[model samples]
Every structure is written in C-alpha cells, then in structure tokens.
Target: MERLKLDVLGLCETRWSGEGHFASGDKLVISSGSPDGGYGGVAVVLSAAVKNSLLSYTPVSNRLLVVRIQATHVPITIIQVYAPTSSCAAEEIDDFYEKLQAVIDAMKSRQVCVVMGDFNAKLGLGRDFESGVGDYGLGQRNERGDMLAEFCRINGLVVCNTAFQHNLRSRYTWISPDGHTRNQIDYVMISKSWFSSVLDSRARPAAECDTDHHLVTMKLRTKHFRRVRCKSMAVRPFDVTRLRNPDVSEKYSVATENRFSLLQDRYNEECTPDELWDQIQAGITEVAEEVVGRRVRKKPPKPWISEEVIALAERKRIARCTGKDQEYNDLKLEVRRRIRCDRRK
Candidate 1:
C-alpha cells in the first residue's frame, strides 16, 4: 500500500474464512467469503484516511463486498468482486451476475460507484463496442468477456482499463505461470455518466503481492465534501502542555480557582450532583480556553514512498519508452519483489 500510495485496494480470491473486518497495521481489510468453505472471497482494504470516512459496508456474498464512504461532497460506493472463472459452470456464472446486478440495483443513483476486482473475464480488445469498452483492451474477446461487456452496457458502466492507452504489456493484468499466456481479465469500471471524472486506469504489472494477478487501479478526479456538524458540538483540545512552565501552571491554577469560586455562588446549595459537575466542567473549560488555548489539529503524515522505489519506477518508465524489454522486465520484477517484501513487513 505504501509503495503504490493506494487509498483503497480491491482484492479477489481472498479465501478468508468468512465476512468480517480485520486490522493490518494502520489499514483495515473488509472481506466477504463463502460461509460453507474458503475457496472464494473478495475484499476491500482501506487506508486509515479513507477508513475514517467509511459510512458502512455490506458483505454481499463469497464473491462480493460493498463499501460506502462519506466523501466531502457526496457518498461513494465501492464494490469489490471475484467473478466465476471461465471453467466454472454456466449456472454458477449466471448466479454471480444476478447477485452483482441486484447489488447495483440497490445503489443510489447519485452516489459515485466504483466496481473493481478480478472478473476472470477476458474483455478482449474493445474495438467495435465504443460505448462500454475502449480500444486499448488486450487479447481477443471470449464468451466470459462478452458477458462482462454486456453487463457494462446494460448498467451504463464504462470499462476504465480499456479507455486509456498504455503499452500492450502494461494492459495485461494476468500472466500464465509458464509465462507463455497473458490476458486482461481483471478490471475497474465506473458509471458512464462520470466518465469525465475518470482520469486514468491501468494495470500495474510491477506490483508485488501474493496473488498471481497484477494490481489494477483507477484514478478519479472527484472531490470529497466535509462532514456537517453542529458548532456547539465542536470540541477542541486544550494545550495542557503549556502547563509545563511553572508560571503558566500557577496562572492556570489561579484562574481555574477563581472561576470555580464564582460558579459556586451561582449554583444553589440544593443543586444535584449532575448540575454541580456540569458547572465545574464549564468553569474549567472556560479557564483552559482563556489560559492554555486550544490545540490545532494537523493532517496525518502521508505514507512514505521511498526514493529507491521512485528511482526504480522512473527507470521502468524510461526502459519502456526506450524499448528496453529485457531491462524493463528485470526492473518490473524487482519493483514487484520489493513491494511484496514491504507489504509483508
């Protein structure tokens, strides 16, 4: 996650035992898997910043998971899926799409929706279908690919990966273990109406992970709105650290004592314990604000992306541009290996 600087990562074939959330360091992993077995699963891993805005999440099934987050301007719904493989039964494939469609149907029309994962459907070069697919797709269209394209067309979704132009090698998201076969089965899709908001989408072959599939990402140009709240409910931290100075501490103590004395005169002797406590709290807060002042909140530090990774990424770019296939492959593999090791740490 730190290597790629990803905010949210969709995972397929997670093979987790069941549907639930798990903590991995600072990030959170929300997954949905088969209740009867652990053969299939889907998950969405959220960065701390993004997780803070999470409104809710739903475990659709072993093959799907939906997450809703409260953005600054609107709510965004993200759906992670693990579709049936080509070898799977037709009935099972149909069932998977049916469940997926149902989830889409339930979504609010105004909310931004991002559906991404390993579809296991090779959406070959999207040549003829200009509306739902782009011309940059890899390989020839298969039956499963047809189903995926049709699904997108029906739902007014656009295939993000095909829309962008990248190197043929960069377009393929999966490779055979023998290194003889490659295909673009995994994808990221968004509502057709918001196509302009989609900056780019591509496959990161150099991404290191345990899975055989490469990481696919989509960048959107949308902005988040700040959460609304009552002003009276706003709470600021007092700069108690100022009390480290003897002079400041003495002054604060004197001010608090004076305020408490005044509050005691205002409250009746018959006041309940709760009322007295409230008065005391108010007095202390007033003195603290006037004496110590409130502490300012700072944005959390961004995840570190090291210079080594940056240099390697730049080298990869240059190698691609210069048509250094062997060098590019070597660097890509190194980058992926480093990423895998970093993530494990």
Candidate 2:
C-alpha cells in the first residue's frame, strides 16, 4: 500500500488461484487460493523491511496463510485469513476455525503472532466488557462475532481496532455496493503479550483501492531490525575484470588485508561461532565494496534491428490504423525485408 506507506498489508477475498510468493516492485506478495482460482482467497503484501528478513510462509488453503519474519526481540508470525462468509454453511465455518486453531498452536510461544484480515464477523459492543474484544466496538454482536470472540479468548488475543475509539466513518471496514449498509467485519488481532506494542489500529476509509472493504492499518513499536538483501533482490557480482591491472590488484589486496586484520583485532574468546562468521563476512564485503566495486549491468543490444526497421514498423502500424489494408500489408512486408537485409549486413 504505497499510498498509505504501509510496511505490511493483509488482504482478503483476493480471488487469485494457487499459492506462492512473488515480487511486485519493491514489495513482495504471498497469496493462497483454491486450485480452480475462484471464490475466497487471502494474501499478504510486505515491503522491503519485513520481506528481507522473511523466515518462512505457509499457504494453508484458499482462506488462510501464514508468514513469519525476523523482528526485534522475537520473530513476528503473521496469520492472514479470509474467513468463511456469514452466508456460508455452519460446517464450513467450523472447519475454518479448526484449521486456524491448529495453525496458532503450531507457532512458538516466544514468537509474536499477529492474526489479521477479513473475518467477515461483526464484533460489536457488548453489555459489559469482553475478554478478547473491547467496549468500543461498533454495532451489535451477532453469531459470527460470538464465535470470533470465543476464538480470541481461547488463543489469548485482543481485537486491536475494537480497543480504540473511532468515529463511524473511520470504524466501518466494509460497505454495501449500493452504499447503504456498512459494517466493521475486518480486524487486526494480536497476542495479549504484544498488545502493548500496538500503538494504533483503525480502518482507513480514505484509501481508494476500488474495494468495498477499507484498508486497515496497525501501528506497532519494535526495535529496528537491519534489512538483509532478499533473494529477489539479487546482488550483481564485483568487477573482477579490473584485477587484471597490476595497480588495481594491489589496491584490492591491501584493502582486503587491512579488513581481515581489523576483524582479527576485534575477535574475542567469548564471541560465538555465528558472531565470528558474521564479522569475517562483513569484513570481506567491506573490502569488495571499497576496492572491487560491482559491475554495471549491461542491457541487451540488437544492432541489426536498427532505427530503419523500427521506423518501417511504425509506418505499417499507422497504415493499419488508417484502414489502408493494402498499404499496411505492403509496409509490413517492407519492414520484414529491411530487417532481414540488416541482419545479413
């Protein structure tokens, strides 16, 4: 969500088929759906921060998936779900929760689990206070809401948005296509232990994603974790060709020597194996960055397919658009001939 500048975003009802992860610009998308590519689906888009430190991900089914990323004190596990709609059968709903509970139980106790996305459940304000839900919820609790509440209580989670007081406009997450009815069915839930880290959570009605559901955002405070280069962001190799020059070779050698010696000086008996390995890797990388430098990526070149061929193709395109079938056909042939002649030359 570049418009909102979100680091992590949970999506529901994506309707995309299959399951996998892919890079979309600077962000990474992980999605899961039915094999037939229809009905409900869930996905998560992550920016470079969390994408870089990705630990693992599981595509449970079309309705659910899990993604884990390394964070400050502990790894953060995100479970994104597209729960069964209220109109769905009771058996389907029960099955969804059973699988969800299994997923939650599999997570480590030390990990910070964040369960979020469209639950299709309306958790409303109750008479007193609810364990998982807060008093500031909207509307009135329904059957689906009761089930969600019970699930959160069993898992020791708090519905983040319900804990905060917000106006109707910023509270409701979904609206009817006719713009009549509105409800707060989507939510961001997190473990009670990390509930304090949730600074704010609310539905952003201003976001224009052409969807009935508004974008839900949650602010969490955690120590800054350094981002590592992800697999998708492959690094270009150093320009080893420069080493052919005696001066350049000497410079690289001296820089590398200094780096290794500096690392050796800092080495301590108390340092673990991982620490020692990291130091050595960092030292080697620093030397390469300073002395060797990365090679400039080269673009594909087709000298034979020259400007003349491109101009001819443009002329053919114009002729076809002008409804001059004979002229267009002639020009197309001319373009092909020119290309062939250029290749021979």
Candidate 3:
C-alpha cells in the first residue's frame, strides 16, 4: 500500500483461519476467514492514513466482508467479496448474492458505498451491459456477469472501472497462469450517487505481485473534512479529582459559589437561554481552573521502573560515558534494587 500510495486495498481468497484483525508495520489488515472452507476468505488492508477513519467492520462470511470508514464529510461503506466460482454449487452462489444484497440494503442510501474484489464474473461488454455498466467494459457477459449486473441495477451501483476508458493491458485485471487467457473479472463498483466523484478506476497490469490478478486501483475525488483541532481538547480539564481532599473540596465549593453569585446579576438581564448557559459553564470552568487547577496528566509508570529508578539509570549512563565504571555499576545495582522495592510496594 505504501509503494502504491493506496489508502485502502481489498483482498479475495485470503485463506485466513478465522475473523480477526492485525497490524502489519504501518498497515492494518481486517480479515474474514472461512472456518470450514480453508481456501475462501476476504480481507481489507488500510493504510495508516485511513486507519484512523475506520468506524467498524463486519465479517458476513468467508466470502463477504464489510468495512465502514468515517471519511470527512461523507462516510464510506466498503463491501469486499470473493464470489463463488462456477465450480461451486448454484445454491452457494445464490446464498453469496443474497447475503451481499442484504448488506448493501442495510446501508444508508446517501453514503458512498463501494463493492470491490474478485467477483469471478466476466461482465463482458455487450447488450447485457446497459443499465449500470458503462460503455468502456471489456469481454462478453457471462451468466455470473448477468447476476452481478442485475445485482448492481437493484442496488443502484455503477461499475466504476467500466466508466473510464483504459487500454487492454489496463482494462483486464486477471491473466491465466498459462499466459493464454486474460479477463476483467475483478471490479470496483460504487453507488450511482457518488459515481461522478470517482476520478479513475483501472487495472495496473505492470505492477509486480505474487498473484495473477493485477492490482485494481480507484482514485476518489473526496476531500475529507480534517479537523485540525477539537473544541473539547482546547479546554484542559480541571483536576476535579482533587476534590477528594477535604480542604480542597471546601475551597472549590467557595470558589464556585462566588463565581455563580457574580453571574446572578447577568442572568437578571435580557440574556438569552444560550447566553445564560454559557455564563454558567464559563463560571464553573473558571472557578475550577482557579481553585482546583488544570489537570496535569502524568506519564504512566514504566514497567519495573519508577522516577527514582529512571534518575539512577540516567546517572549511570552519564557515569559510564565519563568512564566511571565503579559509579555506573553502583547505579545499576541501585536501579535494580529500586525496581524490586517498587514492585513489592
């Protein structure tokens, strides 16, 4: 993902053991695995930039997975699927589409919805590709392709890759291992409401990967509303915990009482309810800050080490650098002893 500069990537047939998520260096992988069918699984890879936007993920089966991202202005729901091949029973394919349609139906209609991954359906271009398929599609429509096309029409989604014109190399996403057959079975479909926001969608056949399927990338023209600062973060919380002290509690009560008494005169004026509420909130916060003090967040104690041990270690470092072996050894012993004492306490 870092090399490709992709914010999100979908994987089909991941062959994972069970549903779980794990972090790999800078990327986060959310996998949905098949307990019974070891070969069938799906996953979504999120870059560090997109990880923070992740709202939730639901593993509908080994074949289907849904990931929701809270993107700036518009949230996004991505459904990744590894559709059953023709070799599978017809009932299984029907079940896959039924589960997929239910997931799409559950989503809000206005949000940006993207269904991507290996459909194993060659939605070939022709008379069958009209309602949702764009003019730049490749190949001839197969039975599975018909099912997918009808699914899109019902869900109001557009084949994003077909909406743009790309060369044959960039159009076909999969090539047979024998280097004989090439097809466009993988796709990126987006809701019709935000279809125009899709800047580009095509395959990168030249990209190197272990699989025969080329990487399918889609560029979206979405400027997520990034919040530089949060309103609550600006106001440092008062050390209300200090109220546990009897003297401190008395002081805080007196200070708050005085502040509220001063606000009484303003409340008598033609102040709106909003203004009154602001005055009350400001008075409490100000009194708390003045008497209780802003809460000082202390660093969590390091395992087996306290402030004393840390100071001892720093001295040992300086002594070692100054070639004081004896002092360094003494400090080292002291640090160990201090850690033991802290643990006992």
Candidate 4:
C-alpha cells in the first residue's frame, strides 16, 4: 500500500469470512464476504487521507460492495465487484447482474459512480457498441464479454480501460502462469456522464504484488468536496495548561467572569441550559484564542520503508531493465520474501 501510493484500493476475491473493518497500520480495510465459509469476498482499503472524506459504505453481497465518498462537486460512489466466472451457471451469472443493477439503481442521481473489479469477463476489441466501448480493447469478445458490454449499454457506462489507447503489455490485466494467454478481464468503469473526468486507465504489470492479476488503475480529473455539515467552523480547543501559571490563571478567571456577567445581563433567566453552555463554551474559546492562540497540529509521519528493501527493489528494477532475467527473478523472489517477513513483524 505504501509503495503504490493509492488513496483507495478495491480488492476482489478477498476470501475472508464474515464482514467487518480491520486496520493495517494507518490504512483501514472494510470487507464483506460469505457467512457459510471463505469463498468470495470484496473489500475497499482506504488511506488515512481519503478515509476522512468517507461518507458511508454498504456491503451488497460477498461479490459486491459500495463506498460513497464526499467529493468536491458531487458525491462519488465506488462499487467493487467480483463477478462469477463464465464457467458458472447462466442462472448464477444472471443473478449477479440483477443484484449489480439494483445497486447501481439505488445510487443517487447526481452522484458520480465508478464500478470496478474483476468482472471475469473479457471485453474484446470491437466497435459494434461505440458508445459503450472504445476500439482499444484487447482479444476477441466472448459470451461473458457480451453480457458485460450489454450491462454497460443499459446503465450508460463506459469501460475506462478501453477508452484510452495503450500497448498490449499495459492493456491486459490478467496473465496465465503458462504466459501464453493474456486477457483484459478486470476493468474500471465510470458513468457516461462523467466519462470526460477519466484522464487515463491502464494495467501496471510491473507492480510486484504476488497476484496474477495486474493492478489496474484509472486517473480521474476530479477533487473531493467537503460536505455541507463538515464546512461549519470548528471551535478551537482551549489551552488549559496555561491556567497553571498564576498570572495566566488570574487573567483567564477575570475574562470568564466578565463574559459570564455580560451573558447574564443579556439573557437573564430566559436563557436555556443549552444556550448558557454554548455562550460559556464560546467565551472560553475566544479567551484561549486571544491569549495562547490556536493549537497547530503536526502532520502524521509517513509509513516506514526499510533501506534494505528499497535497495533490493531498485536492483530488481535494474535487472529487469537490463534483460538479466535470472537475476531479476531471483531479486523479485527476495523482495517478495522480505516484504512478507516485514509484514509478519
């Protein structure tokens, strides 16, 4: 996560039982899965920065989940899904689409929706549905791919990956172990209304996660807006520690008394408990701000990355670039092993 610099990451086939929030260092992970046993699961891992703007999260099913984040101009709804494979029964595939459509329909009309994850559908290169797909897609269309394309057409969504042109290496998101097969099964899709907001989308095959699927990401030219209620002025905390000084204590006491006297003269007995508390709180905050000034918060420290791992990663990259395949493979294994060891600790 630290290496990727991702603000929000959608994970498919998490295979974790039950549903709940878990903490990994400073990151927060919210996942939903099957109750019967580990099988299919979906999750969204948020960085501390994006976590603050999170509005709500819903676990639609073991295969799907939605997270709403308050953005600048509009709310952004992200739907993460792990669709059933093509080998699955037709009925099961139909059920998945039904539930997915319901989730999309439930979203607010004004919200910008992004649906992404492992669709297990290979949307091939075709211009038959020009409005739903671009000419840059990979491979040939199959039954599942047709269904996915149809779903996009009905919902007025554009497959972001296909919308942008890229080389073959950057187009395919999944690769078979035999290295003979490559397909663009995973995707990131956004509502047609905000299609222009997507700057680019591609697969990062060189990313050294142990998964066979490459990390697919879409860059959006948008910003998150602060919510209305969140825009209200926050009362600065009083510096109570200053009260320990005799001179400061006397001054604060005098200020409090003067403010209270003015409040009493203005409201008398008609002021409710709530009103009185508010006035007092405001008075203290004012006095503190005037006397000691508002507190300055320090930025949180970045996640630590060891120098040894950094050096190993650099060497691995160099080896790959120099065509030292054997050395690159060895260093890649070492990097993964070290990462696992560090994560365990």
Candidate 5:
C-alpha cells in the first residue's frame, strides 16, 4: 500500500465508532463520530506519506464531518461530507447545504480542497459529464437533487467519478435500502480547477459486506516528476494581522488616492472627461510595461490636492485660465458646488 501511494481514505456512516481495519501499509489520520453513537458517523483515514497533521476534526450536527489536514510539501486539504438521507424533509437538506457552504468559505485559504462522500441526491435528470452512461437511471428527479446540481455548478465543482461512464445497472454507487433500484448517490466532486488532478475515480463494487453503498475510490494524481531545483515549496501562515493595521492600510490607500488624483489632474489638463476615461483604459497596456521595465516601484497613489500641491496647481490654473473665461470659471464653481451637495446628501 505504501508503494501504492494511497494518501487518504474517508468513510461516512461507518457503523462502529472505534478504529476500522486498514491494510498493513496504511495509517489512521483521524476518526470522529457523534458523541451519542450510531445515527450519524463519519471518519477520515490518512496515509503515512502525507506530511501534514490533522489541524481539526469536527463532526457537524447534520452528520457532516470535516477533517482539516495541513500538508508540508503541498497544502492539500480534503473535506468529506455525508448528507442526511433523502428520505428526510426538505428543510433538513437545505440546512445541510448552508452548513456545507460555511465550511467551504472557511477553508478557502487551504489552496486545494477535495470534497467527496454520499450526497444522497442525484445531480440532475439529463445532464452530461464529459463522459458517463447515457441512461444512468436517476429515478424521478427530486427538487432538492436539482438544487444540489445547481449548487455544484455555482461552486465550480466537477463530479470526478464520471470517468467510469457506467449506467444504472453497472454505474450505481449505492443500492436502495429495499433493494428495489440502484442509485448513483455517492460522489467525488473536486473543484473544476483541481478536477485535472483526479487521475481516475470509480465506485467500487460491493465487497462481501451487507452494506447497500459501495466504496467510492478516487485516485488523485498528486505525484509530480520534477528535476532537482529547490528541495520543496511550502506555504506559511500569511500575515492576516496586517489587515488590521489601520495606519498601514490607510497609508497605502492614501498613496493610491494621490496617484489617481495626479493622473486625473494630468488627464483634465490634457483632455475632456470622455477622453480621460479612454486614456485610463489605454493605461492598462502600460501596466505590463511599467512592471517589466521597473518604471514604477509601487502602485500609483490616489490624486489629492495637498497644501503644497494646491499652490502649484493654483499657478497652473491661473496660467491656463488667464484674466478672461468667466463662464468657464462659473462652470467649475457650479461643478464643485454640486459635488459638495451630493456629499452632504
């Protein structure tokens, strides 16, 4: 199994609370469950190869569990969730979605997250994966299931298990409790960006066990072949505290404002309002040139009329206006007055 490079194994609704069996080569990352017992249980199993440690293990109220892993070489995270049974009420499923979204938002900085488990909802009636069984018999599409499909789309996730393309008879991930029909409920959904890493995924056939759900197996192609450059690249905790520093942020903002103001003044002197907008847009092309040529060491500051700048500006204004042009002066005063009025309102 070590040679196999199996990074992690996750199981949802494992009946027993204690450690489950693992092949001789694997190791347990963390296993969590409801403190009470049976009803809703989930577990995460990690391999010895991964460098990260379990940052947190939370078994949520809706029978959802989160295993936060912090890898050293690569910051790869796995979020496994098992939704409540479809037989449950619609409100219950909606709640599940809300909590799941919350968890996703919190884990955004993890770089890559692989979400998988028994969603207990068919994606949609007639949607296509890049490749899949045409008649994957989804029994009548339920409203909640449709919503889940929409959720996946909105979140930019792809069902990785679609590579198998097996239909209802051979494509089912779970069997109906009554043994009436097979349904493809379990899934391995990865972010569309990371979907490329899913070398292949499949719903394993029933072992000699009595369970209705088959084991969902997904092989992530995390291995990389690279020539020696640096030994490794690791991401450290970012300085989020800097965001709280008012002086730092304010200074940067002020600098940006000054730059904008300077640009605005130059634009106003050179062209009309419509032409100024055109100039700003054309400036985007110079952004690459600025960076490449190292012409600007920092981002431009916003434009502001400081006391010193105002004196120089007054000189330029006088030179541009001269003693005549009363109507132009009147128009400028009116514009300034309107700005003040709008600010007051």
Candidate 6:
C-alpha cells in the first residue's frame, strides 16, 4: 500500500481475502469474491482520512463495491468495479453500463457519485495504429464508445480524468500486463451534474508495485449541505430569422462552400450544396469556442393559456414529481394537444 499510496485501492482480481497493513495507512473496508470464479475478487481499502469519512459501504456484486463517505460534511457515493477483459463480448460490457446506470439513478441527486475501477475500456483517444498521424486511439471498447457516451449523456456523468485534458505518449494511463503495449483502460468518472464539489482526480502509476495496471485517485472537496433551487423559467425564446439575414446568409454560404471544397479535395468526390452546408456547420461548431452545438429549441407551447391548459400543466408537473417517466411523457403530449387546441381557438 505504501508503494501505491492510494487513499482507496480497488484490487480488481485480488487473490487473497484477509486484510493486512501496507506501507501506506490503508485498511480494508470490504472484500467480496466471485461465487466460484478464482482469481477474481474486489477489495476496497481506504486510508485513515478516507475511513474517517465513511458513512456506509456495501458489496452490490462480487465485482462491485459501493461505499458512501462524508467528507467535509458532504455525502458522496463511490463505486468500484472490475470489468471483464477486452476479449469479452461487447454485450456484456453494455449490460454492465446499464446496471451501473440503474445504480446511479437510484442515488439521491444531492449525493455526489464517483465510479472508479479497472473498466477495461480505453479511456484513450485513438490514433493511427502505426504512424499515429490520425488522432484518437483510446477510450471505450470498440462501438462501446457511443454506448458509454450515451450513458454519460443520460446520467450527466463525465470521465473526470478525460473531461478537460487529452495528451498522448506519456498521457497513456495503462499498459498491458505483459508490458508489451501501453493503453489507458481504467477511469474515474464523476457525475457531471453533482461533481461540482469535487476538487481533483488523478491516476497513479504502479511502477513499484510492478503491476500491469496503475491506481486511480480522486480527492473530492465536498459541500457542507445541498439545496434544490426553485424552477424559474423555461429556455429563452430563439429567433431563427436572425440566421437568415442577407449578411449572415452570405457568410454562412461562403464558410460552408470553403469546407466542402476542402472535403471534396481530400475525398476526391463531389458534394451537394446541402452537404457543403453540413460540413461548414460542423467545422464552425468544432472550432467554435463553445465546443458543443446547442440543440435548436422549438417554439414554446403556443403562448395562449386557458383553464384546461393550466390543468394539464399541473398534471404534467405531478407526473414528473412522482418519478413516472413514461407518464410524464404522456402528460406532456396531452398538454401539447391542449396548447394546440387553445392556439387554434
């Protein structure tokens, strides 16, 4: 443990069960083993400071441990998971992310959620295999990247380690057990919505441990208390006409034409005007300071209001409050119908 210096160490496939003191002040909180699967178990070991903040911990599965801590009087739930190797079926990984999503959904919104462990998925940006001329060679497993991205989008989670940084070579966070090739497969994902209180997260190298995989650490600065703000207003009104002005239209056309010219020159293919516009929009959004494109909002529920509309809105709010996602959508449809009826009147 001293060699690792981890506040919380997640032994993915620990062979032993008993606890022992390490060079660092780490104590085993819980050790769980797979039913009949040898060489596959997970142990949660925490340092003195971490143990002092322990509120509760439970083993959700043989390969998973859920621990709750109160740091700085703030509550946070940390889940340690050990995923199967890369050779396993992608479906299995998808199921794992699904299960994890359910667990995260069950947690209270006020509580911060942090997941750390050997995900066995590249938290990397993939690069061209040989020359490395092309960017991006890490993160997720095959098509699992989109799946993981969707999961994060729905859950408002962020791979905290990769959220704000991406550098290659020395940036590779993991290496093969045989030390043949280097890759980053482990991750420390934080709930983007709730991790505002987190101070920092880092992954430590296990050079001295002589282990193939390294250790990940997260130092979260918790908030004393939490509160929910009252709902104020919906999205601001948008003006599509602003984008259709003569000056704006010419600029948009020129920008899009230039992008298509480059694409055509590279791919040696003709591109339609619409395709050129798409390429232009992509380039503008990619290099834009904002980084991400905003979804254009439709017109707000026809401004006109009526008694029936008010009643429908109330029902929709109740559905949302009661945690009935399907019912909430149905209520929204009904409310929209009423708005349309009122607008027609």
What would the TM-score be for candidate 4 when compared with the true structure?
0.73
Give TM-scores for every candidate, taking all chains together and pairing residue i with residue i: 0.68, 0.67, 0.66, 0.73, 0.54, 0.53
Per-residue lDDT of 1-345 in model 5, one digit per residue for the tens?
233345777777865454322322335545555655676666677665442355556666435667655553455567777788868887888888998888778766536677788788775435554322123335555665677677777666777665545544445678766657777787777777776777777666522122578767778766522223343333233343453678655654565566567777775465877877776655543442332222223333332323443344344345333643454355446545554554464
List the lowest-lDDT window of 10 residues for candidate 5. 288-297
For the record, the alpha-carbon RMSD of candidate 3 to the native fold, in angstroms, is 13.9
Off by over 4 Å in 1: 128-131, 225-345
Worst 10 residues of 3 by lDDT: 298-307
Superpose all Cα atoms of candidate 4 onto the true structure and report the RMSD in Å to 1 decimal. 5.8
Model 1, residue 229: distance off in Å is 7.0
- In lDDT terms, how accurate is model 6? 0.61
Give Cα distance to truth, residue 275, candidate 4, Å: 7.2
- Residue pair clashes in candidate 3: 124-139, 124-140
- Relative to the unseen true structure, what is the C-alpha lDDT of residue 11 in candidate 6, on a scale of 0 to 100? 67
Q: Estimate every model's Cα lDDT from 0 to 1.
A: 0.83, 0.84, 0.83, 0.84, 0.59, 0.61
- Candidate 2: the clashing residue pairs are none
Question: Per-residue lDDT tens digits of candidate 6, residues 1-345?
Answer: 444455666667775443322322235346666656565577777665566566777666656778777755457788878777768787877677767777887899877788877776553464322211124335444554445556656766767655434344424567765557876666777776656655655455523232566555665555322222335334343343555578656666676667667766765347677877677676765433232224466442433568787777777766755777688678788878877887788
Per-residue lDDT tens digits for candidate 4, residues 1-345, read 567667889999889888878666577789989996478999999887777678888988899898999888888999999999877899999999999999998877888999999999988986655448887889998889989989998889999988888898889999798768999999999998898888898888777455679989898988765445533456555567777899988887788788888877888787899988898889877877776666565455444556798789888877865878799889989988888887676
List model 1 lDDT by residue over 126-183, tens digit each: 6646448999999898888889888998888888989899998779999897669898
**Candidate 3 lDDT by residue in tens digits, 1-345:** 655689999999989888979876567889999786569999999877887678789999999999988876778999999999889999999999999999988988778999999999988874334457887778888899889998988888889888788788788888896768999899999988888889999998645443679889999988543334578877778887899999999998988888888888657657888989998998887787778898887653334446677667668767755778688678877877887898797
Task: State the lDDT at 333 in candidate 6.
Answer: 83
Error of 5 at 212 (Å): 0.7
Worst 10 residues of 6 by lDDT: 127-136
Query: How many residue pairs clash in each candidate at the backbone level?
Result: 4, 0, 2, 4, 14, 12
Q: Is candidate 4 or candidate 5 better by lDDT?
A: 4
